[model samples]
Structures are given as C-alpha cells and as structure tokens.
Target: MKSNIIRSVLSATALGVLSSSAMAHGDEEHAKPRTFDASKVEATAFGQEGNPKKVSRVIHVGMSDHMRFSPATISVKRGETVKLVVRNDGQILHEMVLGTKEALKEHAELMKKFPEMEHADSNMAHVKPGKAGEIIWQFTKAGEFEFACLQPGHFEAGMVGKVLVK
Candidate 1:
C-alpha cells in the first residue's frame, strides 16, 4: 500500500514536469527533435556518427531538478565513439549540449537570448521530462569539454557537467 502511494506521487510529479517543459517549448518547431550541423560545431568537440563498432562505451547520464547532473564528470578515450544515454528524471525540460568550456559558456549566453533554440546535433541530446535521449559521438582529439542544459535558465542554475577525453 505504501509503495503504491509513492508510485502515484512519482507519476504525478513526472507528469507535472513534462507539462511545464512542453509548454515552454510549445511551438512544434521547438518540440520536435531535429539534427543540426555537427561539422560546424568544432573539431575538438565530439561529433555524432553512426559507427556502432567504434562505440567503445555507453555512458548513462541523469538530469534532475536542483540543476544537477549525476556523475558530474565523464571520461572517454581518444578516437573512441561513445554512446551517451541521457535521461531526464526531473519534472522539467533538460538537454545535454557538448562543447569546450569556452564554447559552452558562449552558447549558454546565446541560449539566454534565444530561449527557444531548436537543435539536432550528434553532440547534443535534448530530453523532455520523463523522457530519454541519446548522443553517439566520437572523441577525435584528447581534451576537456562540457555538457549542459541550454534551456533558458537551466545553465545559470548550474546544470552542467564535464567530459575528459584522454
């Protein structure tokens, strides 16, 4: 009986979050997921690819409320194609945009200006509340990068993470 009550609460909470995020990205253009130009994203940055054999590892990331990402930092090998499976466990819209620290900072600023930015890039996976998304990309070079939610105030709220490709 106790477990049932808890499950009901959880379901309601998840529904509330999805509803809010849907409203935020209500326009069909923003709600529908689309792929963008990975070539222009940056050479050092991870780019999306379909090389399944190249995928050396699968990483599961969780985005939740309080502007947090579980396992804040991830590591990968150079020349490795990693599968990033990100899930939004919170009751809001969230995303994982991968890039260098500087690039992320710049992009975050741009997000503030264009809160409704739509994207479809291999290096980015935006998930709605209670939904899961994936990004399969190869780390072409060894370096540091970041992933964060570009949803309006999410980045500012500290929803960011680091990726170290060595």
Candidate 2:
C-alpha cells in the first residue's frame, strides 16, 4: 500500500510537469509576433513642436577651420536624453558623428569604402558650415563614447569630443 501511494504521487508530479510543458507549447502557438510599421515612425528635429522636449542636456558643438570641437568633454547621466546641436562655423562641411569609440573606429574604416557615408540614424547628424543640425539621443548604457568628424582625417586633426554617459 505504501509503495502504491508513492507511485501515485510520482505519477501525479510527472503529469503536472507534462501539463505545464504542454500549456507552454500551446501559448507559443497562440502568440502573435510583434511587427512595426515603418510609416508610423517619423524624424523630428530637436526643440520642435508636438514632440515634447525630452528632459535633455544640451551640448553645443561648434566646428571651425582648424578641425576642433569646442567643449571637447561633456558629462551626462546614463539613459538621459541629449540634444546635440552641431554648428559649423567654418567655411567647409563638417559633421557630428556620435558612437562608441570602437564604433567610430569601425565607421572610419567603412568611410574609406564609401566616401559618402554619413550618419543617417536618429542618434547622429551631419551639418555644413553656416548650417546647423541636431541629434536627439538617449544613451542607454553607461560608457565612454566619442563624437568626431569623419571628414577625411578630421578626427586625426582633432575634431573630436569625449562623451561620458554614466
């Protein structure tokens, strides 16, 4: 009788596990995959209407003929929205490329492959002299990133800034 009771309990435990696994499988069958609509996404300039100004820390990056960025070091909280307004005060085209240091290094190499490669994401922008551009980014991770100009040896010329997100 004692052995029979033990066997019954073991059978019940096995059945419970099997039932849960079956239920999980059923849930997967009923689950719907998430989809995104590209048309629903729109790009808005920073400080624009209809888009609430994110609690952003603004950084005014100025480029000059000597290939340099003013205020080369900036600090911000991790995950805080940042509004980087890049102004080219020089006579030539300049850009503000923001990314991880490694990413920027890789991008510099990729730029060699495609001379026209420009920052086209929501997190980066390119600007020309006498013109201004803005990039709204929220650094989700705490790390050191560099904002530089990949305009043909501009970075080597010292057109770079240190972005500390922490």
Candidate 3:
C-alpha cells in the first residue's frame, strides 16, 4: 500500500509539471498572462509594434536545429508593416528576438546566465518544436536590425538573422 501511494504521488508531480509547460505551448494560453500593450508600444532603434490590420506584407522564416534561420537576410521598405511568420522546423524550442546587434549580444549573455528564464515581448516570439509564432512590426526607420534565437547557447551556435530597412 505504501509503494502504491508513493507511485501515485510521483505520477501526480510529473503530470503537474508537464501540464504547466503544456499550457504555454501549442494553441494553449501562456502559463503567465502576456502583458503586451500594443497601444503603449513605442518606437525603438529598430521599429515599433505594428498594427495587424496594417501589415503590408508577410515573410516566412524557418528555424532549424542546424542553428540557422532560412532566408536570414530580409529586406523591407521604411514605413511598411510586416507580418513575420516564424516556424520552428527543428525538434527543439527556439525563439525570434528582434533587436540591435549590441542588444542581442547582451541579451544572449543574460540567457546563458538564466537558461530557464521566460521572456515575452512584442518584438519576440517563442516557438516550440513543430510549432509557429508571429511578430508584427513596422519599420519606422531606415537602418539595419538583427534577430536571433536567444535561447541559451542557440545564439552562440549562430542562430541569427538580419533585416535591412530601406
């Protein structure tokens, strides 16, 4: 009877852990509420959060276990809003985080320090394996911007991309 009770407790604990993570993936809501405020989003060195209704074009990017983003070089016209559809074709978790080269390097280092940190922002899309995510952004300036999978050592593995706003 004691063995049975112990097994039940262990099984319950495992299920709880899985259920919590499952809540953040697929079509399920995030484990924590996303406090993204579209209206309050401000313009950054790269751009600003775009209005879904104003997206002028759609770009599809594929992330793979090889630590690379297909079509890593992207081009966009200034003042245009783009619907960036990021699909993870790998068997592991990945994310697309848009920022300047300097910022990306800093963030990547932070991720290395805290591997289990959960980061959610308007300029980021965390995707599970075989799943997808989206980030709508408006290129309000004409400059270069960088993006990478800031997942621990993923960035160091060279999972990065670039956007040329002209």
Candidate 4:
C-alpha cells in the first residue's frame, strides 16, 4: 500500500514537470523531447541556424567541471557561418547556450527554479561529460552576444563567454 502511494506521488510530480517547458539538462535524452526543425528555422536577434555545408570556419570550445569555458571570448564576422564544436572535458554535465545577456539571465533564472527542466534548441548545445556537441550558426546581425551554461549553479558560478560579431 505504501509503495503504491509513493508511485502515485512520483507520477504526479513527473506529470507536473512535463506539462511545463524546462531548460535542457545536458542529458542524452530530455524528459520533454524537442526536435530541431531545420525547415522552420528563422533569424533571430542573435542569429539563425547555419547550413553545415556553408560553414566558413570551425571553432572548438571546451567545457570543464571547474565552471569555466576555454577561450571564453570569441570573434566572428557579420554574416559569416561558423561551426562551434563544443566538448565537455568535465565529469559532470554542461551546456553552451548563445543569446543576449538579458535573455541568458532570464533563462538561467528559469533553470534555477526548475532544475530538471528539459529543453533543446538550435542556439544551445547540451554536452555530456567527455562527449562533444556542435552548433552551426550564422551571425546575421552585428553585435555583442553571450554564451553560458545555465545548468543549476553553473551560470551563477561565472560560466559565461562573449561573442563579438563585426
């Protein structure tokens, strides 16, 4: 009888979480799966997803357990298509999400509120420890952008970077 009650509570909690959209947690499979729709991709304030075939250059980024990203600041040319190869060298999960500082901060707050929120978007790459992920994007607009790991306390711990597009 006790086991049955526990199961019921757990199921309810899971359902509640699933009902809302949450940030990705750097897992192979998200609780709420979201597939990338290349056909529907559009330009945004940051940029739009790039064509892998049109990649102008590739940049490698490393994420570590120390709450840091190697070569935090990146430079790119406006309208250039770049392939970001992100690797996780740490033992824990880490993600790289590109956006404006304000957007990142708001998303980070949401992540803190829902630690298990599952999210997947073209602008973000959720990498597992010792594994690699990639994000191909075109810097359509010329401005300064930011990237950070919004995993629970990761962002608050200063895991952030800059992207300058000229």
How far is each candidate from the true structure, as Cα RMSD in Å? Answer: 13.7, 19.3, 11.9, 9.4
| Candidate 1 TM-score to native | 0.73
Error of 2 at 35 (Å): 19
If both were scored by lDDT, which would come out higher, candidate 1 or candidate 3? 3
TM-score of each: 0.73, 0.65, 0.79, 0.81
47-135, model 3: which lDDT tens digit per residue? 99988888999999999999999989999999999999999999988889998897778678656654545446788888888988899
Candidates ranked by lDDT? 4, 3, 1, 2
The C-alpha local distance difference test score for the whole of candidate 1 amounts to 0.72
Model-by-model lDDT, in order?
0.72, 0.62, 0.80, 0.83
Clashes of 1: 4
> Which model is ahead, 1 or 2, in terms of TM-score?
1
- Model 1: residues with Cα > 4 Å off, grouped in runs: 1-50
Worst 10 residues of 4 by lDDT: 27-36
Candidate 4 lDDT over residue span 102-164, tens digit each: 778877876766677766678888888898888888999999999999999999999999999
On the 0 to 100 scale, the lDDT of residue 136 in model 3 is: 89
Global fold similarity of model 2 (TM-score): 0.65
The runs of at least 3 residues in candidate 2 whose Cα sits more than 4 Å from the true structure, single-residue gaps closed, are 1-52
Instruction: Write the residue-wise lDDT of candidate 1 on 1-166 in tens digits.
Output: 6446544654564455445644343223333443444454445445445355567789999999889999799998878888889998998778888877766776676556546444455667778788888877788878887899877788888999988989
Write model 2 residue lDDT over 1-166, tens digit each, in one string: 6446544644564455445533321112212322234454443212111121564577788888798888788887875776777888998777777766755665565455444432344545566568777766666667787888877677778788888877
- Supply the global lDDT for candidate 3: 0.80
